[model samples]
Target: MEALIPTPADCEVRSVIKIFNAQSIVPIEIHRQLCRVYGPNVMSKQMVCRWCRQFSAGRQSVHDEKRNGQPSIITDDLVELVREHIMENHRVTIAELSSHVPQISCSLLHEIVMEHLLFRKLCARWVPKQLTPEHKTNAGIVFLHDNARPHTAQRTASLLQEFSWEVFNHPPYSPDLAPSDFHLFLHLKKFLSGERQHFENDREAEMVVTQWFQSQAADFYDTGIQKLVPRYDKCLNFGWDYVEK
Candidate 1:
C-alpha cells in the first residue's frame, strides 16, 4: 500500500525533528522533496523553517499552543435548539433561524445544521434522504449509453425491465447527438491520446483506464453530461437532424 502523506500537523512535527536531529538538512531541500512526492501544493518552506527554529530553541510538542481568545458561545444546548428549529420547519432559512437564535452567528448556525445535524438544505428545502446501495440498484437507474450489442442483448433488456429502469434511446444514426458517443467516449479518447506506453494485456489497459478515470475531478464527469444539454436542444431545433460536434 502507498504510504499516506503526513497531515499538516504531523509534517510540522516531523520538520522540527528533522531540524534538530539532522542539523544540516535545509528547509528548501525538505520542501522540494515533499513537493515531488506529494505534489507542489503542500505547506511552504517558511512554515517548515519557522517550526524548525522553534523546535531548535527547545519547543517540544507538534500540536499548536493555545492562544487567548473569547471562547465560542455555541454549546450543546444551542446545537439542539438549532436542530429543533430545523425539525419544526424544514423550509426555514438560515437568516430566519439567526433571528431566533440570536446568540449564534449565521455561519455557526449553518455549520451546526450541516456538520452537527448532518442536514443539507437545497433550494429552500431539506435534501431528500440518501438512498442505500440496494435502493439505488433497484430504484430504476436511467441508463443512457451507446447501443452496443451487449447492452441491447435480450438478457440486458430483461434485467433493465426487472429493475424498472427505462433506457432512453437517441435517434438512429445521429451518433454526434448520442450523449455517450459525443461526450463520454470522446473525452476518454482525448485523454488517452497523449499516452505513449502500450499495454501488454487487457488487464493492464483496464487498470490504467480505471486509475485515470478515478484521478479525474468530480466536475469533469458532471461536465460530460452537462455538455449534452446544448446538443440535445440543438438536435431538437434541427428536427432531430444529425447534430455537428
Candidate 2:
C-alpha cells in the first residue's frame, strides 16, 4: 500500500501524540512548531492548548466531539441561501428573509444574520457597526442620537454649550437627518459584519472600536459628514416632510 500523506489536522493530532509520549513538551512549544510550518494565523493558541489538554486526559479522538443541539441543521447550504437574499438587498428585513428561508426559524436566522453575516438593523436599514471618534478635534462637532430625556437634560445641554458641540435636531420619526442613522452607523455596521472577532468586556470592545476608528483614513469620515448636506437639502425641499433616504 502507498503511504498516506497527513492532512494539517492529521499533523496536529500527530503532534499531540508526540507531546503525550514526551511527557514534557508544553502546548506553547508545539504551537511554535506549527507556526513555523503553517504560519501564525493557522490556528488560535487557545485551540492548541485545548487539544493538548484533551490528549492529556486520554481523549484520543482528533475529530470534534459531538455537540448537543438540534444536530445543527444550519449547514453551509442554508447559510448561502440566507446570504443570497442579503446580498441582493442589504436592507431586507428578517420577516422578509423568513419568507425565502422558511425552513429556518426566525431566531436561528437572526443568529446567522447578526453573528455569521455580521449585519444589524439600524432604523430598518441593514448596516455594519462602523463608528469612530476620528474627527473629534475638528471645528464642527455634531451629536445625533435618538431623543431621550437624559440626552435633552439641562446638564447635557450645558456640557454641549461648554464644548461648543452642536447637537443636530433629530426630529421625531426622522432617521435621515442624523449622520449616524444614514451614514456613520450604516458604514460601521458593514465594517464589523462577517468579522469573527469577539470582545470579552466593554473595555475590549472600546479598544477594538477605537482601533478601528484609528485605522480609517480622514476621507472616510469626511465623506460621511458631507452626505448630511444633501440630506439636509432634501429635508428643506420637502418642507420637513418625512424623508426616507
Candidate 3:
C-alpha cells in the first residue's frame, strides 16, 4: 500500500524544524543521497527539503545595489513656474517647459513636476458639463485629498466640504481610475478647439470653454460625450504629455 501523505500543517512545522536544526534524522540532502543509494522510501513523501530551503532565508529578494538615485537637478521654483504656465496657458510641451523654465533637464523637470510638486494639483477641476449616474460615485461624498503641497489646498477642500461634494486624487499614473481625464477634459478640449475663433486671449479662451460647456445638450452630453472616455484612455495609453503650441 502507498504511504499516506502528511497534512500541510504538519509538513509546515517539520519544514521549519528542518531549517532550524540542520542535522540528524535524514537531513533533506541526506534523504536525497539515501534515495540514490538505498532506493526511495515511503517516508520520502513528506520531504521538507523545498520548504526548509525557503525558510532558511539568506536575503531571498532580488539582489541589487542600493545606489543613490540620480542627482536632483530640479528646483521648487522651477516646478512652481511649470504650474503657473499650466494655470495660465492651459498646456505646455517638454521642450516648451524647458524653454520657459531654464536650469533644469527635461527629464529632471518631468520627474520633479510629476513627483515632487505634483503639478496636476495646480489646475482647475474638470467640471462635468452634465452629471449622470456615472458621476454619482466617488471615494467619499465629501472628502479631501492627501499629500499636502501637490494636492488641493486646505481652503479649497474646506469650500468643497460646505457643498458636500466628493474630492479625491488617485495614486500617480492611475489614469484608468479618474473619470474626468477620460471624459471631461476631452469634451472641454473639443469644444474649446471648435470655437477657436472666440479665443483671442487666455481669459477669452477660458470664457469660451465655459460657454461651450454650458451649451452642451443633454443628449449630446449623455451619448456623444461618453465616447470621449475611450479616447482619453487611448491618449493615456499612448502618451500623457502636454504639448505646447
Name the top lDDT candidate: 2
Question: For this target, which candidate reaches the highest TM-score against the unseen true structure?
Answer: 1
Q: Model 3 clash pairs?
A: 93-244
Sorted on TM-score, best first, the list reads 1, 2, 3
Candidate 2 displacement at residue 93 in angstroms: 45
| lDDT tens readout by residue for model 3, 1-245 | 23234333434344434544354433555455434443454224223333334335532322122436874445333454565554344346667778877777788767765664444322223233344342344213534233445456777767787877766443344334343444556668776577667646899777866877788776754664445444444545556533111
Q: Cα RMSD for candidate 1?
A: 16.2
Quantify all predictions' global Cα lDDT against the true fold. Answer: 0.64, 0.65, 0.48
Q: Compared to the true structure, candidate 2 yields what TM-score?
A: 0.38
Poorest lDDT segment (10 consecutive residues) of candidate 1:
126-135
For all predicted structures, in order, the TM-scores are: 0.41, 0.38, 0.27
List runs of model 1 lying over 4 Å from the truth.
Answer: 1-139, 147-153
* Model 3 bad stretches (over 4 Å): 1-152, 175-177, 194-198, 220-245
The count of backbone overlaps in candidate 2 is 8
Q: Report the C-alpha lDDT of model 1 over 1-245, residue by residue, as the tens digit.
A: 22245444454546544654466667677766666555565545544555555666677666545546966565444665776676567689989999999876889988887876666653345432343332344334546655568877899989989988757656554557555577667777887787766889999999988888898897676676666656765766777788876
